[model samples]
Target: MFWQWLTAPWQYEFMVRAILLSVVVGLVCGALSCYMVLRGWALMGDAISHAVLPGVILAHVLNLPLALGAFVFGVGSVLTIGFVESQTRIKEDTVIGIVFTGFFALGLVLLSKVKSTIDLTHILFGNVLGISNTDIYQTVISSVVTLTILFLRQRDFLLFCFDPTHARSIGINTNLFHYLLLSLLSLTAVAGLQAVGIILVVAMLITPGATAYLLTDRFDRMLGLAMGLGAAAAIVGNYVSFYLDVATGGCIVLVQTLLFGLAVFFAPKHGILARKFWAKIDL
Candidate 1:
């Protein structure tokens, strides 16, 4: 009975597509999450994800591909933040807050005025089960490209994230890497739209890497663990959502959060309980 219950969702075609896209989203987000965590760019992820709303709205109006608009706005937001912070005395966080909120508000206003069939709820929260074939293809393409780039440039990105000053001294173009990471982040956000939507996508990009961080000190191990955890969360969450009739995206993120919670107390070296146990042994 348990096995049948677990396998029931795969009986349908839509569920299969949703699961495949969700897994791709999870893996790409998980891989990029490591770089974001190491670089202290968590807020940047939030900003880009939110800032893409206007692009989505514009795409609907223009009858263009939503992913294209999303990528444009996502990358535009990053460039805007970088420019504003560099030119003015304002800090990056403050700039991020202002820019993302402004863009998000603009999107809401446009959404209210636009006479389109775009669902705001789906845009914000995702509708994974309703994913179409086009969305699947788009997501797969974007994920493949993003993953390929990340894999090829892993060493450079790691060095840049760990220490920009050292990377610059060693002749790596820190500027190029900075924008490259942001661009990849934008692409990931676009790919994740159908699986987790804008609001929750950042969580997907954050939680896996965070959970992995607690499990290992090595960057390579962190990447592997985060990717595994993310893919697992997506699979389990989809099954839970199917049986429980909950929001698929929310379920996925909740699963990731639950894993993070477990890691907090159970991870071998960095977990709270582990540290306390080790301390007691020393004493």
Candidate 2:
């Protein structure tokens, strides 16, 4: 049944690139996403995703490298958060609210300036089904960079993630790790944006990790499960979109949602339905 992808004319170089890109992106994002979710930085992921919009729009307007611009903005957003938290009396949610809205508003203005193009939907929602050669390279580079950094400091990262105070007690530069992790998150979000857009990037960064948490007991195992689940979602979503001629990012995100729901209802030790069934047996 799946052999059609090999023979179909539509499954050319670009199609292969999209599938490969999704696999790499899903794997890397899912790994880091578990850390973000566990550390309660899920909203931070959402804020970073939205905050990069202006960078993208300005890049498109200036005809510059979109990835570079987006990366700068992503880093800028994380910096802005640190600055605001230190300087202002406002709470974190308030800061995220102000920053993301302002950035997204700036993006809207820039997009309107480039109003000549009627096909701007891709900027907001992505076009994974129509990935380009350049996009493949961008995704691969970002994924590799993320993996390299993550691998090099895997132990430090684990300590920093599980307990920053303890990490600092051990002479680990906790702030450095935190900002560096933010940089990785920014890069991943920017790379995924081309294929999945800004908002869906939040789903990608959060849902797979959550689903994996339900399926695994160990942190490393959870990351592996999350990556595997993400790959499955991406591949299945692509196939579904190809046959139904639907939105690629949306389908993939919906797949993630379904996976999470299944985990919630059926996980062995912690699931709602499973717990209830066990309670009935005990009674």
Candidate 3:
């Protein structure tokens, strides 16, 4: 019975697709997350994830590709936040909160005005099992593009995140990388939508990276660890969800969260227990 249960998720084509999608989304989100964590952009990830909602609704109305609408709004939200921060005395966090909430509310209002053809639950929470061939293709393309750009420009992005002024001093176009990172964030969010939807996508973007951060001091190791954790979480979460009959996306997020908790308390060098142990030794 245990062996059968282990093999269950693989017996179906939908499961195969879900597993593939989960890996793709996990890898992209996990890799990008290291940068987000280092740059203190966790809230920014949340902002883009929620801000894409209005574009999703608009796309549904116009019968356009959901990815297109989502990408536009995601980028729009980042730009709006940037403009607001530059023009006012308000902090970046405040600007992000305002813009993202306003955009989210607008999406809700638009959703209400339209007929009930759209599945609000699916849009908000996602239905990974219901993924179509087109979604798979789009996700694959988006993942490839996003990952390729990130890998190729890793040095520039790292410099930009750690010290934008220094990057500018060195003649790197900091502004370009700034907007490029935002664009990639949007792209990754859209790719994640089909797996976990807008709500849980932020977790995927932040948790793996944060967990990896706890585990390692090096950025390259952080990236590798995050991706491995993400992929493992997705696989285990999907398998568990299949037997438990729970929401697949939520299960994946839950697994990632659990892993993060474990890392926090048990990581060899940086965990809470480790720090306390070292403190006791010093005394």
Model 2 lDDT tens row, 31-100: 8888888888998999988888888777766766667778889889878887998898999988988888
Q: Which runs of model 3 end up more than 4 angstroms from their true locations?
A: none
- Model 1, residue 254: displacement in angstroms? 0.4
Model with the higher TM-score, candidate 2 or 3: 3
Question: Candidate 3: global Cα-lDDT?
Answer: 0.91
lDDT-wise, the better of 1 and 2 is 1
Clashes of 2: 0
Over 145-225, each residue of candidate 1 has an lDDT whose tens digit, in order, gives: 999999999999999998899999989899999988898888788777779888899999899999999999999999999
The true-versus-predicted C-alpha distance at residue 50 of model 3, in Å, is: 0.5
Alpha carbon lDDT of residue 167, candidate 2?
A: 84
- Tell me the lDDT of candidate 2: 0.82
Query: What TM-score does candidate 2 reach?
Result: 0.92
**lDDT per model vs. reference:** 0.90, 0.82, 0.91
By TM-score: ranked, best first: 1, 3, 2
Per residue, candidate 3 scores C-alpha lDDT tens digits across 77-186 of 99899899999999999999999999999998898888487777887888789987877888899899999999999999999999999999989999899888888888
Give model 3's TM-score versus the native structure: 0.96
The candidate, 1 or 3, that scores higher on lDDT is: 3
